[model samples]
Target: HMTNLAESMEADLKVHQKPSPVIVRDALGIFLSILFWSNHRPVQLDNLTEQIKTLEMKPLNLEERLEYVLKRGNTFLGFRQLNELVLEQRKLIAKR
Candidate 1:
């Protein structure tokens, strides 16, 4: 599932010794937005492979990526998963 993407982001932050809580929050927000966006605008099953290549070249930072996601205006794929990710991020932030 895409939840792994959020977990991986947390691990990356830990490894980098990210110093600001703002950065972590921003990162998670961006990630969640992207995950939701993908579900909203799912790639055609027939063209999934080619679509993924284009998605990879998308904006790398939080603000730009989130802005892009917002423009799409689509529904989310998994509300439960998003909630779980929010909790996970909350716990991680609490630990700091």
Candidate 2:
């Protein structure tokens, strides 16, 4: 979903001939503006504000899925054992 949003915004930014801080700023502004307005827009379909129960979907054995994912590829092993580690990681990313 984040990939799709970045790609769509990149396409929107391509209308400009040159890239600069202002272009990036404007792109972010436009994106945020759309998001701000989108929340207030009327829901034109049923169950638009409904909370979906997990019971509605078929359940899976999470242990099996986690084992499969771990076996299939390399995973980021850091920040798994400690809450402080996760917060530190978030701070580093946010600083960037």
Best by TM-score: 1
Clashing pairs in 1: none
> Local distance difference test, per candidate?
0.41, 0.31
What are the per-residue Cα lDDT tens digits for candidate 1 across 13-73? 4565332444334544554555435445543435433553454323224233343433421
Give the per-residue lDDT digits (tens) of candidate 2, residues 11-89: 5446632233443334333432332233444322233214111112211342333233224212222112121222333
Candidate 1 C-alpha RMSD relative to the actual structure: 13.8
Question: Model 2, stretches more than 4 Å misplaced?
Answer: 1-18, 41-96
Deviation from native of the Cα of residue 76 in model 1, angstroms: 29
Q: Tell me how many residue pairs clash in candidate 2.
A: 0
Which runs of model 1 end up more than 4 angstroms from their true locations? Answer: 1-18, 41-96
lDDT for 92 in candidate 2 is 42
